[model samples]
Target: MDWSQVNWQPQIGDPHFMGWVTVLVYLGCAILAFKLSLNATHCFKQHIQKQRTFWGVVAFITLLLAINKQLDLQSLLTEIARTLAKEQDWYDKRRKLQRIFVIAVAFTGSTTALLLALYYRKIIMINALALLGICFVIAFVVIRAASFHHMDHLLNQYIAGVRLNWAFELIGLALISANAIRRLNKNTRHRASVD
Candidate 1:
């Protein structure tokens, strides 16, 4: 496995209909999250720092994930790992390594979610759906990273001409967007009452 033999080109993992739809959904969600962040800033006005921080974090993560949806950064990472395993003559043991990697990722994601929950406990009730949406997207990403053949096949399958992956991705984005709209409305009402 020569290093020169491996192609280092960027690969577009999904370029089809569902892929584009998913990307659009991600972009829409990112915009909503950003709006939520802005609303948090204007509504709190330096009083509730936690609210500002949480929405800001959500906006950042959503924006990054939206970019990643089209760039397919995960595939690049997987390719690098695969190439390294081959070069190191450990390609045969990739399955074990992949399992370990997936487990580590899942643990890290869960831990981060727990920390966020604890830190934002005061607002969790209001943002619970958005949090759940974020979890779904993260779970979808982790499952894709696991790269199991059967899982890939399943995700590729169509139900009523709709890809499973699209459904999973959109559902998460929808939840986040819904939560953002709800918050924005609540904030507007509160401001009106204050005025």
Candidate 2:
């Protein structure tokens, strides 16, 4: 068990290259989300308040996620947990705190998604609900792997380009991007026709 040999930051494919590539992709998605928010507010006149609020929230969330990915917030939390456990002289408390944090985040995210879905029964909102579902599934898989001491194998598979979580996250981003672009284009065409 040579800890030095363990790749702490195992990413999909080439570790060095893929990490930057994924970060860039996430940044692009965040930019797209911001653009969509702007278009929704300025270009679309109908349902102005609702459209702006929805897109604005989406943009904020996307940007936050992009930043979180870039910063590796989970690792930071892990470090914090380790420090706390060391100070308290409790070995297992780190894992307990980490689990609590994960559960809290998942619960908050799901509740937010459910509220949004109920408020807006549009296709995009439905897609958001689906994205939330995928997130829950991914979390469940990761928790199961960790509980069974199979996380190393799962992470190895992820590094080998079988990253289900990343795939689902990208899919969710794509769905939001597509929906925004479609609405923007439709509004633009309608405006042109009316002019």
Cα lDDT, all candidates: 0.80, 0.56
Show the lowest summed lDDT stretch of 10 residues, model 1.
Answer: 39-48
On TM-score, the leading prediction is 1
Worst lDDT run of 10 residues, candidate 2, spans: 5-14
Model 2: pairs clashing at backbone N, Cα or C within 3 Å:
none
Per-residue lDDT over 127-190 for candidate 2, one digit per residue giving the tens place of the 0 to 100 score: 3643453354345433532342345355445645657555545665666666666666766787
Please give the lDDT score at residue 102 for candidate 2. 60
Let me know the TM-score candidate 2 reaches against the reference structure.
0.67
Segments in model 1 whose C-alpha atoms lie over 4 Å from true places: 1-3, 11-13, 41-47
Model 1 — TM-score against the truth? 0.89
Error of 2 at 73 (Å): 2.9
Q: Per-residue lDDT tens digits of candidate 1, residues 1-195?
A: 455655556656578877777777777877777777766733435445677677777788788887888788877667777888878889899888878887898899899999999988878888889999999998898789777788889988999988887888889888988988888888888878879
